[model samples]
Target: MSFFSRRKLSEQELNNYQQQLNEFKYKITKFEDRLDKLQNDLECKSQGEPLQGVNVINAEEAANRVEKAAQKALPHELKEAFDEINSAVENEQQSVRLFQYELGAYVCANGKPQRKRIYHIDALSKKLKKYGYETKLDSNGPNSFLEVSWKGKETSDISKIDPAKKYVLPLEDTECEITDSATGKAISYEVAYACPRDDKWRIIYDRKICSDAVIVPGKEIIDVPKWVRSIEPIEVDY
Candidate 1:
């Protein structure tokens, strides 16, 4: 055949094309039948009847059960950890909690940073993800706060924290004699503020970020308390 010239089809070729068409039609029909069966199966399930050998369940109910199972499967010491955090958040009307394993350590949401050795991080990741929150696990464990993507926005360098506001813990009746790790000085300091916008906690020495001030862990802490020591939420009144 000349370049760009259409060649007449041979009788055998026409027959072959027809056969291929028939095969495609048969496949399309088979696919449609399967799709219809699936639709009917779903409809029946929606009507409170499951297909043979399949138990129908409400999606939400199923999810609840799965969540329950996940909660139950947590190590005994770690069990109810998430629930405890949630309860505290609910009680305080806050969206996040910051827990430090040690007095001065990487803050984490689910568990203490040092406890990463005992707790299964993958399991924690699963539970957090299932709860519709985004998380990042460092070598130590989960981050200090649970990240939530809003408006279908991709996770980027753009901060979710408010720059104007500071995540300071209640100064009322919160005082500690803990030594400043950054400086080898024994000093008495009250609980300081966390700047989630900057992803750091500033140790306030007489209301100033002194040489001994240290940064706290977390991506954002909009309205969360300045800091918490346990995954169990402590209700801080503002």
Candidate 2:
């Protein structure tokens, strides 16, 4: 072919290009069809129509499923602690309860004044230590308590926690930033712990973020309780 002249494509080359173009067009059409179906399904859902080929669940059933999922996600020790706390609160008896605060964990005894009993501080400390946590027993003070914190440097990163395999039991009103697995965006959530008053722990993400986004804790220690305050009566109500 001359420098300024275009060379004629061979029949084989033309057929190959046409095949490729047809493939591209086919893919685009399929993609558009999928988009249309998704939009139509969403509209039908908004209009309270049953989605075709989809298993629709009632509100109560959906709520039950979510509750079950949340229960499955909770840590075993945390669940046990919550049950014990609930029982103690219900019976209005003296018992030691574990509270997971933003900075650390606190084990506090609830009930009438007991000058002699240490409230199973040693046993609780050992239990916490088994989970790679360092426990400090504070019995010398007026109110005997135990503080639990991450044991080593490796425990500082909350992102290392696998949500599918494990869950962190943070106290109510605790705040943390998490990364959305779907959008790869950072989202902040105010955590509420589950107790007798509340059946499930909840993460209320910021209004600006999509509530449906799957999120995991950001790279920071979320379990460590940084400050200590005067121990007061444990209120399970509300």
Candidate 3:
């Protein structure tokens, strides 16, 4: 004799299976929504329009916008000499960081020659012209910088310098002592150098006591010999 029997799923089992199916459906819906958005973005790009609810700008357009903003920010007297400006903008985010142009000039104060930064746009413009040079905005990889040209020939570039790579010397010739919160040991360290790799201060101490070097945060390092925090950093060959 042959016999066959079928067992039905319990209520709990049925509910679990239903929930899994609903989760799968939800995931499919999300994927479809994403695909639709990508298609719309492609269409907008093909039509030379920005994506909806997203900021986008080309390099040339960004440069013009930055120039306009700089012009407005400049004093009225400097407006005429403001020929062009260079800057970088994140294409997708439309974020910009413009370089603040400076004219390295020297001034005499109290019979001492002191270096002065001339940020006046007009003065910079006039100086550039007097030197038979002109500046144009140019792209350098993903960023932008001013390309200096003399008589229509490219001479040099003015680009943003990494702050951590800048050379610095302590205002006072002394070592700083601080208790290491991590090791609970008193340590003496001197500002050895600025590490360009991670944009942090490299502190050096006796290798016998601690590691050869340790990286310190800017906030902590700035407390020692405060003058190292100058905007116009002193340049030295590492």
Candidate 4:
């Protein structure tokens, strides 16, 4: 290769290495911040001083926003089906439980069978941070999953809001069913949907287990590749 060509290649390689190093540094900084926050929470808890509660918006309000977004995004034909899913979501939100033990606030939401949804707390953390409230997820204890505080004050007082009564839907009944085109075998699937801050719908089909099942999106489930034969929304307690 010519001298100029070799030099150009070397420069490109160096630039790539530098970019990787910068990314590594960014990850390390984030890790350090999480570690420091956890340490601060532990120190405050150890001192036996009263730990402040982390403020969270009403679960009902958060769930309502999600329902409205879903209703708007989904097609008119899906109104009845979507309503069923939305009702289950609202029931779960209304039945959310919060605890003030273990030096932090613990938020809990029961999921289908073995699964327990914790995304709400993560969303709560981001919302609190937007309002200048420093928040950290506390998964240290099985019960508690969030620790909220100010930037300087590790024990700031936060109004504790009780989660609505714990609501859970049985898994024996399936919400939706799909047949694998490849195998022609039909399976019951659990439909889990979420609308994040980005205002986009994230949907998943799982079979009670963590493994994701086959799903093809189209105007109608039957129109998709893996034809969805039938859909039955789980009976949710209002």
Candidate 5:
């Protein structure tokens, strides 16, 4: 064969190239227009003032908080812990109930990791993802655990938590305290302690990342409850 196969480009191939170039140019133009519009819109919105939902925490209050934290002896540690706890409550609004997860001697079932063969907490990650969560994944067992998150204060059409198949969580080896909010009234309500913490669920992720396998959404969003779920549906028991 000759070094150069002297075949001219076909008309159809030339047309295809021209069409592709034209399409690409059109896309570029569209993108530029979008960019320009976005910049203008942002400028207009900025000038127009805050969005409807945005609550602007005043700079004075924010600065005061920082100053207070600075005066504390263990400012850094206390602030970080406080922030974490506050964040957890905001996401899992089931009234700030705290529980522990056992991480030592844990095992994985099927394709996912779990604390025990039974206390399926892997479901928590899925749920949290649905409710707009990401940032951290506290080790959920032994020396650590997935930190407790918000349980939307509604009865999620979840059935009786299954013992065999539910994703595993660290069993509360000993009794844990769950304090009541209303105590200092005419009728004295005492801080409550509960044991055998099994009837709760949490949604957790591997670690702080934008995307992961565990919290992936389902097709119908309803199928989610079946797969990405919880045992301790509201508060921390595990």
Candidate 6:
């Protein structure tokens, strides 16, 4: 190539490098501004010194918000059942025993009928309350159940809201498109649906477990591939 051509190319390259450098500097300034805003918000959230009940944050409220958001995003019947379970919880009592297994027999006298205990429902509210919890909401908003972990000191997954796999085709449909009617958080599914209906389709708008629902992950369960919708997990692996 000619000397002038090479010189012109070098100048263009230099300009491109300077433009990239300016973009990086601009991004750094924007990020620093965001960090400062977040820091100020944190300061506002943790504004008080330690105090008893008077200045305490209610964990129930936080959990309820999470549940409510899920519920409101679900259908009416589902939210109703959810409310029923939440109502059954004894105040300040975290764990609840709802049903007992048939003591799942071994069909042999050698074993003690394998007394397998099944725990669920209101047992959830209290168990979740025990952890060290904090949410960015007003302290005087709503009440919540808080539980401390029996094993670890950290408060991440204190408890699982064990859903009763009811409506096992004995109910209605499994796969559903639900939303929190109250909050509008949405979920679309292609699983089984199990519920009662008058030949009319009920638009699900909240948290309801459609038992035996088929959820295919990383592949298409329906004709049109739906991504971002994680297959509903029947059980979580710790």
Candidate 1, residue 41: the lDDT equals: 57
Candidate 2 lDDT over residue span 1-238, tens digit each: 1112234658875675455545533543344344334555566787988787865545565546444433332333333443554465455443444432212333222322223221345455554454444567775444556665431123234444432332223342223333443464554333333211143212222222222222222221233322101101121111
Q: Cα miss at 197, model 3 (Å)?
A: 74
Higher lDDT: candidate 1 or 3? 1
- What are the models' TM-scores? 0.23, 0.21, 0.20, 0.19, 0.20, 0.18
Write model 5 residue lDDT over 67-131, tens digit each, in one string.
Answer: 44323212222223334544554464533222223334444433334333211223433333443
Which of candidates 1 and 6 is the stronger one according to TM-score? 1
**Predicted structure 5, TM vs. truth:** 0.20
* Candidate order by decreasing lDDT: 2, 1, 3, 4, 5, 6
Off by over 4 Å in 4: 1-9, 52-238
Q: Candidate 6: lDDT of 231?
A: 19
- The residue pairs found clashing in candidate 3 are none
lDDT measured at residue 104 in model 2 versus the true structure, 0 to 100:
32
lDDT (C-alpha, whole model) for all candidates? 0.36, 0.38, 0.35, 0.33, 0.32, 0.30
Model 5 Cα displacement at 64 (Å)? 34
Best by TM-score: 1
Question: What are the per-residue Cα lDDT tens digits for candidate 4 across 82-157?
Answer: 3333443444421122221323333232211122222334444444344343456665444655444422212212
Query: What TM-score number comes out for model 1?
Result: 0.23
For every model shown, the clashing-pair count is 2, 4, 0, 3, 31, 42
**Model 1 accuracy (lDDT, Cα):** 0.36
lDDT of 2 at 149: 46
